[model samples]
Target chain A: MSPADRFARLPDLLAADSDLQRRGRWVTVDCRVDVGDQPFFLALENGALAAFERGTRLMRSSAFTVGATDEAWTQHWQPVPAPGWHDLFALTKRGVASMEGDFRPLLQNLQFFKDLLALPRRLPERI
Target chain B: MAPVLDPMIGRYLRLQIDGVDHRVYFEEAGRGIPLVCLHTAGADGRQYRHLLADPAVTSRFRVLAFDMPWHGKSTPPDGWEKSEYRLTTASYTAAIRAFCKAMELDKPVVMGCSIGGRIVLNLAIAHAAEFRALIALEAADFQQPWYDTAWLHRPDVHGGEACAALVSGLIAPQSPPVSRHETLWMYMQGGPGVFKGDLYFYRVDGDLREKVKSIDTKVCPLYLLTGEYDFSCTSEDTLRTAAQIPGVEVQIMKHVGHFPMSEHPAKFREYILPILEKIS
Candidate 1:
């Protein structure tokens, strides 16, 4: 019922999204999504989501890390989020979220990654 | 079979801009006051297809939309591969003026979106007397650096796909799927590096904050319309720009985004039709 929970379901959601698979067919990366104090790590292989888990040990590496407050993530997942919170770059520009690490993988697979993260919007509003 | 024909007519004109001959493609429909529509950056005039086909719009205003050189059906001038394409304020304004002169459009009402939107302000500042009025959509005098544009035309990335993906979020989710995809399709078809070249004017050379203050809206009425859903050119940005110029009209369109005319033409019409009527 939270953005973290939704993050956990991404593997399943992505496994079923054929269009996203095609879009990310060449993308392979290990990334981290930090929602406030919580961190969700994702492993994407080719077009499929290889693994998604919470918590990472010290010195663990990720291609990129997208960090924002849990509230930011929640608002971003709203069916129709407010203007500033509606997009990744928008959030970054507003200083609400931060993108760190190599940008090549993210930029090359921008639509897929953007859509992948936004998959949680389908959840009920009350959640 | 019932043969169907669209009112819109497409044509090419040989124009000499800055003493260089360039072939430009334009589409038009209707008659009366000339309403020149400028497409968004990285896109062609096809963005106004709906406006060109709409009888309501075509009946009163002669709507014309043209693709800038190196965009859509318009071909870049000779020896294009030898030089990097960078759309500067000076070159962009000259192209618009040259197109108008070549077409013999007399004091036409010019409407532009995004980069096209920003150029109208420049046009107003430099050549206000040459235009009847100017309508700017999703525009502002200055924009904070959002992202590096180099990724747009890099050999490592599919420039067209990257460009399309990056801007996809700028469209409001409420827009119809067909219209939204149609808008992105144009970005996907943009010439390699052309989108980034256009952004050079948008992000760098096109800051008009100090100069926008010089615009006398009385000489040529300026109407600015920004979509509520557009983060690229937020309504706040337009309001800030409007606040700089006295007597300039500003409207914040709801449920619309960057590509108003293309992404959601039907909804866009609700906002534009009234403005056109007001102009008439």
Candidate 2:
């Protein structure tokens, strides 16, 4: 899938997840996901997704950034990621993924971020 | 304010335990019966810092807290990489036995929290005659379904940050900001792979459901205390485990989580003093 196409599907996938909505109910944070060179930003308000945009430049403030190489992103989006690709932290720990900026929000709402990122994993492989 | 009673701080000692030289860091305070304290997973002897400094508790008993091998100020044994720094029950038990023996602590009251808490049960069951009593905080027979270490154990996963984030959730919501930060800081400083190694003992290799019944209360009376907000080892989980072991006493601390001694020492002390009175 094209980067834009993949980014466009995140909002719908996030919205449809009842567990994510419920667990993220109290969370409100701006998160950026950088897949290879393609960057996407998501704004979560009160545990619900508020906005999503595809761009390299972070126009607005962001709480944290989760970035990874194309190969790493591909493996992470797999139905069942291999050992090192299974978690964002795992990817970061393995030196394949990079996380920067404030960590409080990501740590505080860890489950939400974990579930949110895993959404693409649940998507059909073709998409 | 009451004058603080100074604890007898001991220097870090390099002791030969389980046949390898291990740098065991420990501290001691107070005067009477020995109370050997164990720390949580990924953490060190500092978890019991408040206990060692508390005047009320120390005056009545000599409190000792030591870093497990490869944790805090303690160094892992030679050729530790062979095991990838994993903590097995056999290794944990051997260390505890060696620590007690080296200190010449005669039948000390063994008190531990989390991983420390879980090991006291093993100590009581396997070597009951060595301890005068056992005080286990936030301990359970098993922690399946509630916690998972698969992601943390991934070779690429940075065990320190991942484990710190994972444990941060288990802290009580009402814990003081300073207490919470300090508790998280302790986990952050843990050696790489050490936390996952310890969890191997806590979550996997430390299954004691069948073995607990063999614990002779007469040899070492058991007291179980769990924090109200410790989701990993909930009060209900501890209570359930307590029920299976005859003569096991149980209490649940309010406004505390997994790291009771570090997260809320005053409240933890309130719960502990009463138990000590009965046991000591």
Candidate 3:
């Protein structure tokens, strides 16, 4: 399957996973996750991933943007990524990823977002 | 009876720290040289549960783990609500000294993790003669804060859950499911704003690069063990800090991360048992 097609499945996959739903119970925000240069905008409402947009919309704004290189994302989803690649913050701390925009919703629902971004790991292989 | 009682004993003592009365909670077991264990930031003495329970360690050393004021079962000093909780270098070392004096621990070996790891260097610097040895885990001389700590205690966030989640990534995936979750539970139970308060010391007040050379390893030996997966204070950080102190021993543990004792007690035991033997 194409990478975009795989990302398109994020909403349904996230909604179906009860554990992810519980973790995101308090989160409601639209955030953009960039895998390398590919942008995937995700809308999280209350506890569910409301929408998944594969491409950037004109004049579209997000609550936050969390991104890493294709290399970093690939490493992070390796069932067990190496020491510096295991976590989003880990990637950020190591200078391989970036998180910017309004800090409130992003930091408040950090775990939810972390789990959300790593959802691809549950897939059979790296997307 | 199927019910199993732990070999460790728990008790509380009222001690004066910085002229404030603090009811500190502590647990201990075994007998020999006094081995005082210090927990990580925002965590209590309970992190050392496995160490305190192990017969191999206890038989040769009196393992004592104490919860600092404002952590674990320990109570904050009177009028704590009016002021912010920021741990400074002086206050941290002073508390350890006072605890040691009150307990009459004669030159005890002090072993600590995370924030506990940072302070042991100061303990060695300011008062090396007061200890038999110092074991530092997941430690470095200095670590810049990687994220805004304010997120840890914001009104909009569930402080406990946020704190636990933020730290969850620091534990290695190689750790057992039970040990990993148990380690995070400590953070989940931390008091509001306490984790941020601890970072005040970890990130701001505890920069030890300039002062570490003052640590005299001759008077009290210094041992550092960092897990391979702890990006916060990566193994490189431990090695760099160890290089600063002549005769300081350093080892990088494989298949473990931060919160070694809590996240993988059995694995942590493999690394620490050898050190305990060397100290013996």
Candidate 4:
């Protein structure tokens, strides 16, 4: 499928996924420029592990990840995958900016982060 | 290891006190009435590096500094013992008494930073006759028995690497570098059980303000100080605390936070030294 088609279809896929649910508002993307053969971006809220790697491919490491509480999050010292994930997440969730990132990884691991976006929907089923 | 004494300081000592028998780590420089300085939580006595370096500070008095037990080179208490105060506070107060007797100090002026400050407050309340004067930096009153029960059961606020990372961010300049050992030491010195115990008992007890009013000390010049961003106490709260103690003096170090001694040394000395000279 074309990159545009994948981008356009993600919302529907999230809505349809049994194992996912949309949380907060729009999802965030991190595009790692350097690190290894593939660079991945992660999304987070309150410094909890969200999802990442829109431009690269890697197998699912875990089905779901948790985030730290607001206090713990404030104490988190590790740098995030991308530079602007926090601010961008805030802006995009508030409808201030469009979701934007490079296209290479989205074409590679399109399914996972999209599933991540669909995470909120699956919560009732999981519980 | 002999601490790498900063040339800024003159003579240093490693002595063992009689009552406690625990190592008392101290450094002395310049001369006048002696000022005994205690470090804040999660730090050694050496934190006074900048305070000792100031020309103005050295001119007025002899500064003697020591690390609390389980901090710096001092050893931890061998066994648990109940007292009027919590474990950490008790050892520190005992150490102060022992330090005084060993040195034959005649009510030497005393100053403490953060938890160290809290210890001095407790000392003044219990042994008011021993200190010529007292000053505390961001010291919270734990004697009134205030505590947060909810937090007592939770994991150490600094439980793991994430917590250590957070601390590194707070004291990055003081922290040498990132390593598991350093992180673990931070958590240990910021004692897992005792740290929470002190906080829980002190926060919920609710009578610390009143207790401060009754301390029968020499009206021994008492000064309460904190930085602009102190997490433990706000300027408003610390000032209110000072007001509760009849003769307590108060000062706020600007452009710094909880660890004012490390973050704003020159200002820390600027405020504390003169008080030592006056008392000495």
Query: Which of the numbered candidates is closest to the native, going by highest DockQ?
Result: 3
lDDT of 1 by residue, A1-127 (tens): 7667766677777878898899889988999998777798888899887877887567878999998888888889988887778888888888889999999999888988899889878767664
Residue by residue across B153-173, what tens digits does model 4's lDDT show? 234332222222222222212
Candidate closer to the true structure by TM-score (higher is better), 3 or 4: 3
As a whole number from 0 to 100, the lDDT of residue B44 in candidate 1 is 98
Model 2 misplacement above 4 A: A1-127, B1-8, B145-147, B153-157
lDDT of 3 by residue, B29-51 (tens): 99999999999989899899999
TM-score of the second chain, each candidate in turn, equals: 0.99, 0.93, 0.98, 0.72
Model 2 DockQ, alpha carbons vs. true complex: 0.05
| Docking quality category of candidate 4 according to DockQ thresholds | incorrect
Rank the candidate models, highest TM-score first.
Answer: 1, 3, 2, 4
- Calculate the i-RMS of every candidate, to one decimal place: 1.0, 12.7, 1.1, 14.5
Query: Residue B183 CA error for candidate 2 (Å)?
Result: 0.7
How displaced is residue B257 in candidate 3, in Å?
Answer: 1.2
- Screening candidate 2 with a backbone cut-off below 3 angstroms (N, C-alpha, C), the clashing residue pairs are A24-A47
What TM-score does candidate 4 reach?
0.56
Tell me each candidate's RMSD, in Å, in order: 1.2, 11.6, 1.6, 13.5
Can you give the DockQ of every candidate in the order shown? Answer: 0.74, 0.05, 0.75, 0.04
Name the candidate that leads on lDDT.
Answer: 1
Candidate 2 lDDT by residue in tens digits, B230-272:
7677777788888888889899887778898898887888999
Clash number by candidate, in order: 0, 1, 0, 28
Question: For each candidate, what TM-score against the reference?
Answer: 0.98, 0.70, 0.96, 0.56
Model 3 off-target regions past 4 Å?
A: A1-8
Residue A34, model 2: Cα distance from true site in angstroms: 22
lDDT string, candidate 1, B1-280, tens digits: 9879888999999989999999999999999889999999899999999999998888988999999999999999999999999999999999999999999998999999999999999998999999999999999998787789989998888888889888988998789999999999999999999999999999989999899999998899999999998989999899999999999999999999999999999899999999999888
> What order do you get sorting by lDDT, best first?
1, 3, 2, 4
Per prediction, fnat is 0.58, 0.03, 0.74, 0.00
